[model samples]
Target: MTNQVQIWTVIAGLGIGTLFIRYSFLGLLGNRELPEWFLRHLRYVGVAILPGLIAPLILWPEATGGSPDASRILATIAAITIGVWKRSVVGTVVAGFGVLYAVQYFTG
Candidate 1:
């Protein structure tokens, strides 16, 4: 069907675009030491990206039909607390998921 073909075309285009974006930096910076200023800024990339990716999901979750849910809010708080206290990615994820399931179990 034409719709299926269009979907596949879009998927392929996205895959290629993501690949090129990832490879561009590696290829362009091969065997080169980045400047200290650039390296310092790069350290904040994850810090910036994590909050950007999470804020929307916490504030307007798709599962809740874009509504703010208590479970998600509490879980996000717990995750942030654990992340700040323990400074561990795995710990933060575990705490978030655990709190989410616990809240869902009790509330639902």
Candidate 2:
């Protein structure tokens, strides 16, 4: 069992670490214009984040221990296709749900 002092110390340490990270970003780069190379990488942040989000869904459909569902796979495919073909946000969502519902009904 941990003592009160130890628990308070851990909480304090975490709070300090969070503040330091957020402040460092705002302090160092907030004032200056980012370099061209940095900007180029930042432009790809979406490419990185989007796939990171989608990949887990496709690869680990039932990561929480339930049986995997196929509708999600079909929806993702439609979203990617719509995103590629029309490059429209609405189109992507509509196509994705359209695929999901269609797959569900057809499969059911």
Q: Name the candidate that leads on lDDT.
A: 1
* Superposed model 1: Cα runs more than 4 Å off: 2-22
Candidate 2, after superposition: displacement of residue 59 in Å? 2.4
Full-model lDDT for every candidate: 0.94, 0.86
TM-score of 2: 0.70
TM-scores, each model vs. reference: 0.77, 0.70
Which residue segments of model 2 deviate by more than 4 Å? 1-9, 63-69, 105-108
lDDT of 2 at 53: 88
Model 1 CA lDDT for position 45: 97
User: What's the true lDDT of residue 9 in model 1?
Assistant: 94
